[model samples]
Target: MPTRRRTLLLIAAALGLPRAGAAPEGGYRFQRGLMGTRFMVTCYHEEGELVGKAVAAAFAEADRINEAASDYIADSELLSIGKVPPGTPVRVSPLLFGLLEEAWAQAEKTGGLFDPTVGPLTRLWRESRRRKALPDAATLAKAKAAIGWKKLVLDPAESTATFTVPDMRLDLGGIAKGQAADRMLAILGKHGVPCSSVTAGGDVRMGDPPPGKEGWNIGVRNRDVDRNAAELVLRNKAVSTSGDLRQFIEIGGVRYSHIVDPATGLGLTRPVSATIIAVNAATSDALATACCIADRETGRKLAAAQGAEVFLAEG
Candidate 1:
């Protein structure tokens, strides 16, 4: 698998001091490296010790999810699946099975715009970026041949997945971080942390507003201006962004984003960034990717269908 890419979104810290009764002393914040990116959790709780334990649990949950889904991990379930013979069903853990199901559904919903089967394309681009050159037409063709969500077979009942085409690979990098953030928030909730937020890189998931605030304030970065374009007050929601600004390769005076178009085996060129706010981090993350691959109108329609809002920045 290709080396992991940097988180594509930037989230500004909430501005201002916590309101009265936010926590006994103040909200506790914790950050750690997980899933090849920084995962942070902030919680409001009466007991500092409880907050610590809850944060630890949340991070642990994130790590567990990452271990199961990360394609960069050599022994990860995702990589193990790729190692299996084509057309041979390989049973996966419950977590991976569930995620695979969700990914397939999202891929279908977006007409394959958001596909986990783009691993081959991702690797090709990564190599091209490393070499400071574009992949040759033959190599690009081979990579494209290995991409197709329809070619991946999933058996939910048996918790098994298979690739119809040889050398096909799956990469959950597009959606796993968002799912991990959501799972971390769930772990925090299970520990009785009522108001909290978990950010797995760019995918931010919040349970509720702080003790006295209407909603958590989040900043959406504008790469063209190198400033925050807008700050959104959100509660019980998730936001994610996909862009080429920070993670891209320049070749022959043209910029190629890390966000690849699986359909064409090429990186997006026009849209500099795409952001989405939705009811869940996973959906928001997948939709953000879909927005990057689609035209503005089509992207907006996709987000609207899911009761989410999308912002696309183009040159």
Candidate 2:
């Protein structure tokens, strides 16, 4: 929504030569614009035609998820849920249901620090950034009143979602990309390409090592792109970074990040960046956001509790 902030994490091509038994076509990299950002899938396969099809399938899956989860889309499934009256159960696709379940679980885990129901506040923040002004107290209170993890109920048995309060909305900006990346990687694996990586905006999900390489090289960029970046070698894992580095606005000389704090009903005032590494992108993506909302010590504990690692920097 905010011009798709440049990802703090960058992928560096592995330096190793192709190993024995590797595909003769070497590797393939495909890119498509989706979900307000560039979605890329890099894979190794025996047949070039298969690789193209696989990438197309993966991008199609991303488009499906975006149409369902995107808040910016006028007719998105997410918006449809808000159109119904309070207490009405809205049947959702299994994919949307699964993503809501993950987001809900993370919200509970973070004690509401990472909430998908903060759509009201997000809307206000987006407008605030555009106008370079903060919302009035009354308006801010109204938006905050409509946000709470408990207000939205997910019924897995029925694959339905119910809202207990009026004017409630859903925003999956934090976790949808990760879920899409995970699904894309799975799709690639199904196409006989077990060694692959999917980058959806800031979320990166990778499977297996590239040919002979031990792992993919991921470079975590600093606030100053001119500075040296920290790199990590990882495989069969996922990493995500959330921060105010690029997506921020200055109002009345105060810097406001795009990430909203549910407790305050406003964008975070501090300069913070959080990168999380976990078994999958969904976990890492949600954790990275929660990490940014918390202090460094609490952020580390939050990641640790989820069996993830956090690299948090605050100023």
Candidate 3:
């Protein structure tokens, strides 16, 4: 709710030529560096004159997706829903609907561990960090009360989102990356263009890398290394990573992760990181977030339930 914000990261695209076995189809490659994060977009066809136009078109889609899910912005659709009273019909695009619906399912499957209604909690952390402080148990508990998916009433009939708890807020930054990838894939296909991919920071959605190529090559990344770097391999699938290795703050020599566990209003310490591969980006994204908050068993169960291939890195 409150429209989504950049509590998440940000993007663009520059396509590469066919390297040996890369996809056969050719297109214009564009790079985008907007949002807080950077990524690239590549299409199957274009002309020197159309280069600028194609870049604009691809990023226009990214911009729309970002606006819908960013918490930093105040007028995003997600934010609009937070302000609306329960049961009010709100028109939403198919991509947003799918993202929210999947987010709802993942939250239930994870037993609130992956709840999207944590805008208030994340906002607290953002403020707490800025204030050079952390939330006390009392404050955290109160914030936890404001978090839960059941409190949301979503109606497909009218595409309405209702909040059962007035204080409850939804945050899609954690899952919107996948939705964006899915939408981009659709848009690319609609144009009958082939051989390309889109990457937003760590989340990447790739097609048959120009034809003849096996698939999208990816590296699960060692966060200990440079963040901008990743390994390369063919993995015709969506992959995501979550860990306490990075994005943490040190207090008294103890590191606290940025990824919060909705179950306890804190973050998980064990299982340093989790990398999951799934057919859909949203499932992998949601599961990665969920696994970060769950124990090994719980994570395993949920991963299987989601039909995701999960590899847990023991700490």
Candidate 4:
């Protein structure tokens, strides 16, 4: 393969939406961090009495849902699902079942291009990164074969997840952000907050738009080559981009992007960057990765067909 320039997915998160001034009140300082990202929920209620109760309940719910969906911990229900014996009928929470359904939907829509079962490949890359050495083609193929979204089975009535293939596995990173956004929005609504915003790392959800602020002004970085200068703004939506150049290996005039192609099981040689703005954060994240991995022209076409506004910095 002639050395192809690997593209980097340049993503930006902006919550610059404007609305009426925030009501003057003291909302609880709701804060927590997990999976290397911080979540903050701030809201005001009409009845002061409900704020505390609502927040407390919401936090508890968030914690429970997070525990069930997170892939970072070994004991998380997700890891258990991926590691447990197939067809064992392990129980899963309602929220987790919802997340799984959404993930499966995305996988189907993206034609398996936005696979959540990419955990094994991601881990192998992580190991290679730690060792500061690239995996041989054979090792990459081994890990790739072990990863596939199609190999997982879901039962809606039973709320059970099973791995059809012994080595098949999943990681919920793509769906977690959107789930968090949805949960936070639910909490905000429950607390009677007319408007609010929730941002966890790059995933952002807005209730009404911070008092007097226009729609959130999201900024897209120009690869590792530029700074905050290049930004894109959208209204009432979330944007996500996947980049390969961010942390990649450049060997012998060949660049290996971190955004692995599900079909090839190898880092993409094309350096296409995709920016997708959609109704929710999870969709944006998944589409961003899928488009970048699919490369520029074809990925952009797929994104457009999905009703997501697409922006590309073709590599």
RMSD values for the candidates in order, in angstroms, are 7.8, 7.4, 8.0, 10.3
- Which pairs of residues clash in candidate 2, taking residues 3 or more apart in a chain or in different chains? none
Cα lDDT computed for each candidate against the true fold:
0.82, 0.84, 0.66, 0.65
Per-residue CA lDDT of model 3 for 1-315, tens digit only, reads: 111111101111223211111222444444455456665665444333343344455556777878777777888777777776654556777656767898898788878878889888887766655665678888888888877888887788877677776666778767777767666765665555545576666567766565555666677753454553345554446777777675676554555676777766764545367777777777787788777777778888989987887766665
Runs with alpha carbons beyond 4 Å of true place in candidate 4? 1-32, 40-62, 224-235, 245-255
lDDT for 118 (candidate 4) = 82
What ordering of candidates by lDDT runs from best to worst?
2, 1, 3, 4
The best candidate by lDDT is 2
Give per-residue CA lDDT, model 2, range 1-315, as digits (tens). Answer: 111111101111122111112222357666667787877777876565566566667777888999899999999998899998999999999988988999999999888889999999999989998888999999999999999999999998999999999889999998999999999999989988888988888889999888889998888764655653579999999999899888988999999999999999988999988889999998999998898898888888889998998887777
Instruction: Give lDDT tens digits, candidate 1, residues 1-315.
Output: 111111001111222111212122257666666777777777877665565667667777777888899888889888898787888999999989989998898899899999999999999888988898989999899989999999999998899999999889898889999998888898889988969998888889999788888998899974664678899999999999889778888898888889999877988766468889999999999999999889889999999988999988887
Separate clash counts for every candidate = 0, 0, 30, 16
Once fitted onto the true fold, the runs of candidate 3 whose alpha carbons sit more than 4 angstroms away are 1-28, 43-55, 84-95, 226-232
lDDT of 4 by residue, 79-107 (tens): 88766666566678888888888998888
Lowest lDDT 10-residue stretch of candidate 1: 2-11
Q: State every prediction's TM-score relative to the real structure.
A: 0.90, 0.91, 0.81, 0.78
Residue 114, candidate 3: alpha-carbon lDDT: 81
RMSD of 3: 8.0
Instruction: Specify the poorest-scoring 10-residue window by lDDT in model 2.
Output: 1-10
